[model samples]
Target: MSENNNPPEEKKRPEGITNSYRERLKALKQARQYSVAGDIPKAVERYSTYLYALASYFGVTEDKLSPSFFDTEKEISELLLISHAYWDLSKAYDRSPNLHKESIRCLDQFVKFTNGFKYQHINAQMLKKFIKRKQAHNMKAFQNAYTKIQVDSKGCFIASYSYGPEHTVTNDLRKFKQAIVNYRLGFRFVEVYYNTSPAIINFLEKSGIFGCLLNKVFIRPTLLLISKSARHL
Candidate 1:
């Protein structure tokens, strides 16, 4: 008999795990494409599929795939991806009417999985505060608080912190934002400011003296310039 010359066949991944991984990849691809296309509902559907498949690939149920079940040191990347998916899902739910409770649940999961990571554009701690405030108040109260948060998140962190939410200076800053936000450059500046200012304000608030100093040295001076500019507009 002729000696066998062919190499042994490579071992295949378990069928279930292989299928789960393939589904996860497919769902993730569809989710991102739908998101980029601004088909939020479709994106949300695909994201849900991705999450389920990810859990299956990891040999766990979706709820059991949280940080509590995973080894954080070994699986930080996986946890972060899960956190990001939850965050995106939360944002999608927020845009849908009658899904506030679902949005809050997804935000809670995002916060849980994002324990050590810091994101500039989305303040997870601030989002937790909003969630707590929403649960403790009536719908109207929650709406007002949510509106204030949305406004504050735009670019008025220091102004809102120093002068109070209703202060004339804060109102003036908001009006200035409205005036300039119509222009492309102005909008981009506000976008950058919004992404960066929250962390600065968070730090300042934690240190009282620094907050005071910043208000006097930077915020007040900027407010003065804004006031002067308002006269010209």
Candidate 2:
């Protein structure tokens, strides 16, 4: 018989983990392509997908995919992947017009992951501090805009209708609305909402039971989201 010279096969990851890793890699590749092509929104979408896949690959929820949650002794590769994903995603979000808060969050995650690394370039910690200061400045701007809005102006008609106009919830929703209007396309959206919401509010007011049902189904969840997002801020 002829002597066999074939090398032994390499060990493989389990099928599910391998598939998840492939999905994460594919998303990262697409994100990079979009970033290079100057399609930042698309890049952000793909990077988010990559993060979701990365979380799945590690069998953790997306919120729990941070470095502090991983076991460094056994998951160095996972930690490295998470670090690079956060870094790239932060860069992508930084370029997005409406994603300032998300950009800061991603950068924070990147800084956390890279804290102990010996690579001397980038100075992510310093960059984060600078970005945070800029964010504080932006928040002040948002506050100024909020103050400019007339108190009588029906803010977030749906929210105002659901939670009485003078309620703290309504005021919080107004603040959120002001933040949205500070973004690039946000003013146009507000215009559209202003034009259409009066009629919707009228109808909701007329249909008392239906409006109550809708509030329970819609407004409650929105309030929950707002509460969570406020905590992040």
Candidate 3:
């Protein structure tokens, strides 16, 4: 007889609804409503409660979560935004600035943790914008202590998805850097009013050399302290 040497398969993880998940979902919906209605404190309360539910129901620590029910990428992304969302809501509290900071930190961590992320629809571009925002926000903090300003470094293309997957690399870091530099100047935005429309995003995504990352938010180079090279910007 042939030697039998198959190892036992590990037990599959259970998928059952706990009372806490139901309560958390209920509260998440409430939080969504409150957020839309301009009642931020209630929204914050609901979100905090939802997190509590998450911690308790999952039988893990505050940061640990059930893999079956939710994705780690999405959960962490939302959590990072929580502080920023709170900051935007309650002007009286240290919510906005601090939370914005926290959000940036969380986002940065997430970027390091995962290979890539698609925020709403935009992938690499969203984090790039977030980095710009954080640079501006933190610059203000640094302004009090120093004279000269500072900005974050340029985008490093880990990979690109320009029409399926392109193993070929395009060194457009200069163009992206120019985009930020131009933004720091007084260049007006092209207006992203149809943010609710994914079709528009899809259209743009399909029609472009750069795909979805080429939205107007990132295009239209900054006006010159001195004019930059046309190709780079």
Clashes of each: 0, 0, 3
| lDDT (C-alpha, whole model) for all candidates | 0.64, 0.58, 0.40
Error of 3 at 162 (Å): 1.6
TM-score of 1: 0.45
Report the Cα lDDT for residue 225, model 1: 79
TM-score of every prediction relative to native: 0.45, 0.41, 0.38
Number of the top candidate by lDDT?
1
Pitting candidate 1 against candidate 2, the one with the higher lDDT is: 1
lDDT tens digits by residue: candidate 1, 93-132? 8765688777767766665665433342454445546566
Give RMSD (Å) of candidate 2 vs. truth: 18.9
Q: Which should have the higher lDDT, number 2 or number 3?
A: 2
lDDT of 2: 0.58
